[model samples]
Target: MTTNAPRHIISLLMENEAGALSRVAGLFSARGYNIESLTVAATEDPTLSRMTIVTSGSEAVIEQIIKQLNKLIDVVKVLDLNDGKFIERELMLVKVKATGAFREEMKRMCDIFRGRIIDVADGSFTIELTGSGTKLDAFIESLDKAAILETVRTGASGIGRGDRILKV
Candidate 1:
């Protein structure tokens, strides 16, 4: 069935052992599903790691993916944040040309976006910004494409709202 499907952020608490991440990624590859973004990091508990995966599919496809994830040996829990209220953020560090007129304009733009100029060079300024993917994209869009020198982004990391926590 063809229908417009929205993106989903699925968070998982899994064993921090080696190869555990590959197994989860393998499942998606074997099924030909696409993962837009993925972030995995060790949690406060040394034994577990939190992984956030972003993907899009129809309702039935997403349901199947969740079921398959729960069956993984390393995956202890999986929560589709879209099922409830959640907060998501992504980090971006962008380096832009800042010389003469562009320098003041760049500083103004960064301030307007609430980003920090983490690094300043004679001809470049590296700005760090954390926000939703859309906000990060907007920041980039607001600048002159030629002014941008480099950009690095950490994919989306998300968590449930109050009373909804993903933990061991």
Candidate 2:
């Protein structure tokens, strides 16, 4: 029986150092698996950084990715959060061109979506929004008529739902 592949959110705990992220990217590039989203930041401990990556692939390919990551010298741990109950969030910064009609309309949409206008200019405003990808899509769609989308950046982070914590 053939099964449709599912998207997976994988997080990695790795020692903070140069080229670590590049190495991981090299693996994916060589294998030609697209990375949908990637986020990395230093942990509170200062010695480690957390990497959250979203990808789509077959179960076998996913296992291969995990195994390849384990072989990296700087990798400390890898956790597949998709299989577990987890809370996922993504941050997006969007700059939109604004005017009279679209400005108020855009503001209304932002207010409804719980997004905040971070910066304002004579004819434009930069908005800061945080939510899942789907939510971001909706927010962007609402502003599509007014916003030309000068720039955008997105980062994904996830924590296990309930009391479950990914231990080091």
Candidate 3:
């Protein structure tokens, strides 16, 4: 397997309105840069939105991406979480087969991972989990591949660890 590239978590504050997100996405697409994951939502300030994007590249490529983002009209500020201490978390909802012998094992695994069974049917269980991306990946790896029916993930959301803050 190929070794993973260095990943960077980029957080930005931008105007909260139609087309803003599209513009940011377009910038990456135009440059042939791949965005591993992206999440955006309106912040407490109605006029602003917080977006978190995960990508991997060399130092020079990352710097260029940041510079280009800063030039966008809707972008107010950009912060690279890797530059300092930051806390990151992602949310995932996974639905898996939970019948026969698999049911008990699935429940046990969820308990071990601190995941909550949010929904249950006769043959399936939907679990809600929140943690670092690595933790989430481990949870998936622990399960039987064929057992996983569906999964929804909210990309990594991050913030500086302490008094450091990103604001316009």
Candidate 4:
């Protein structure tokens, strides 16, 4: 994962106002940076929104992103979760078509991976899995022999391990 570039996995907290996400995304796109995955949701404090962003660039570019993001009017907080103590998780919904031997094997695989079989029909099964990104990838890779119809992922989201906030 080392490309001599700055790969930042950051989380931002902001007001649940309109256009705020757009503004932040626009800032990155305008600068030609890449957003590997972005996930946002309303926080426990109902008035706030949380955004998890994964992007990479040279060290200088990351510093620039930190500075520019702070300048955005609606960005209330910025957290560098790559700081190494956060608990991260992602949700993935995978649909795979199963027939004959694949049907029994698919169920077995799901059990082995601790994934839930959300739906099952004569020819397909929709499964749901939640865990760290790497675990999810491993699950998906092992299911490659089955007929994969579609997959929708919620991207990585997390918080600090303890009661402390990313911002005190």
Give TM-scores for every candidate, taking all chains together and pairing residue i with residue i. 0.96, 0.90, 0.96, 0.90
Q: How accurate is candidate 2 locally (lDDT)?
A: 0.82
Using lDDT, rank the candidates from best to worst: 1, 3, 4, 2
- How far does residue 130 in candidate 1 sit from its true spot (Å)? 0.3
lDDT (Cα, tens digit) per residue for candidate 3, span 35-118: 989999999999999999998888888899999999999999999999999999999999999999999999999999999999
Regions of model 2 farther than 4 Å from truth: 1-4
Query: Per-residue lDDT for 45 in model 3?
Result: 98
lDDT of the candidates, in the order given: 0.94, 0.82, 0.94, 0.84
The regions of model 3 sitting more than 4 angstroms off are: 1-3
Which has the higher lDDT value, candidate number 1 or candidate number 2?
A: 1
lDDT of 2 at 134: 81
* Model 1 weakest 10-residue run by lDDT: 1-10
RMSD of each: 1.5, 2.5, 1.8, 2.2
Q: Residue pairs in steric clash, candidate 4? A: 6-57
What value of lDDT does candidate 4 attain over all alpha carbons?
A: 0.84
Question: On TM-score, who's better, 1 or 2?
Answer: 1
Q: Write the per-residue lDDT of candidate 2 for residues 1-168, one digit (tens) a residue.
A: 123467888899998899988988888899777688888889987888889988878888888888888898999998888778988889888788878887897788778989899999888878888988889888877667536666575667888888767657
Which model scores highest in lDDT? 1
